[model samples]
Target: MKNKLAAGLLGIFLGDFGAHKFYLGKPKTGLLYLAFCWTAIPAILGFIEGVSYLLSSEENFQAKHGRKY
Candidate 1:
């Protein structure tokens, strides 16, 4: 299972390149974030998402972003 704390940190620090999304197994979304990173939107979105991930329950994070078995 993916860890929320790790994902949150990655999102906060490296999410300009969609690091957290990749960690969460959402490559398509990750790629999109990376593709548009030049606009600064990804950075802002990443910080928000990082905070959201940190605030979310483990069950909610897993249900939304965990890898499929």
Candidate 2:
């Protein structure tokens, strides 16, 4: 199971490299984010996603990611 705190922090800090995506077992999506990382879009989006993750209800997070925080 994924740790929401870890994932959220990774998304906020290392998300430009798609660290959170990798942690979530999404290698393909992680690669896509890495490919576009130089554009800075991935970082911005990652930050938003990180915030979303931090704010999400645990049940909702589990339902979406199929794992517990």
Candidate 3:
């Protein structure tokens, strides 16, 4: 889950390429975010998603994305 954590943290800090999405096994989303990263929307949204993930409960995460480990 390190990747996911990194992605969420980095994504919020540096989500130009949807790093969080990539970490979550959503390469397509990551690419999409990367495409629009220059606009800075992805970065903002990434940060939000990152924080959400960081604050989310383990059970919620597992229920939503399953055991990525």
Candidate 4:
């Protein structure tokens, strides 16, 4: 998806279930996040991660998301 902002927002909002992590191809981390999601740590961290994603440059985001130039 081109809209990293939208995905990041969704990650912040629904990252408790590791939805964002899944979308980003981090299934292992996503599962862990999902497992401990009830603690709210994943949610908070996911929100911060989302904001960081938004703040990062496009090339950086593409790399994180596994996109090619």
Give the higher-lDDT candidate: 2 or 3.
Answer: 2
lDDT agreement with native, every candidate: 0.92, 0.87, 0.76, 0.80
Runs in model 2 deviating more than 4 A are none
Worst 10 residues of 4 by lDDT: 1-10
lDDT of 1: 0.92
Candidate 4 lDDT over residue span 1-69, tens digit each: 446876688687887778778888779989999899889899988888888878888877877685546
Model 1 stretches astray by more than 4 angstroms: none
Q: What is the lDDT of residue 62 in candidate 3?
A: 62
The candidate that achieves the highest lDDT relative to the unseen native structure: 1
Question: So what's the TM-score on candidate 2?
Answer: 0.90
* Candidate 3 local lDDT, 14-58, one digit each (tens): 777787787777799889998997897887898888888778877
Please report, as a residue range, the 10-residue window in candidate 3 with the lowest summed lDDT. Answer: 1-10
Candidates 1 and 2, the one with greater TM-score = 2
Which has the higher lDDT value, candidate number 1 or candidate number 4? 1
- Stronger candidate by lDDT (2 vs 4): 2
Question: Each model's TM-score?
Answer: 0.89, 0.90, 0.80, 0.82
Candidate 3 runs further than 4 Å off:
1-4
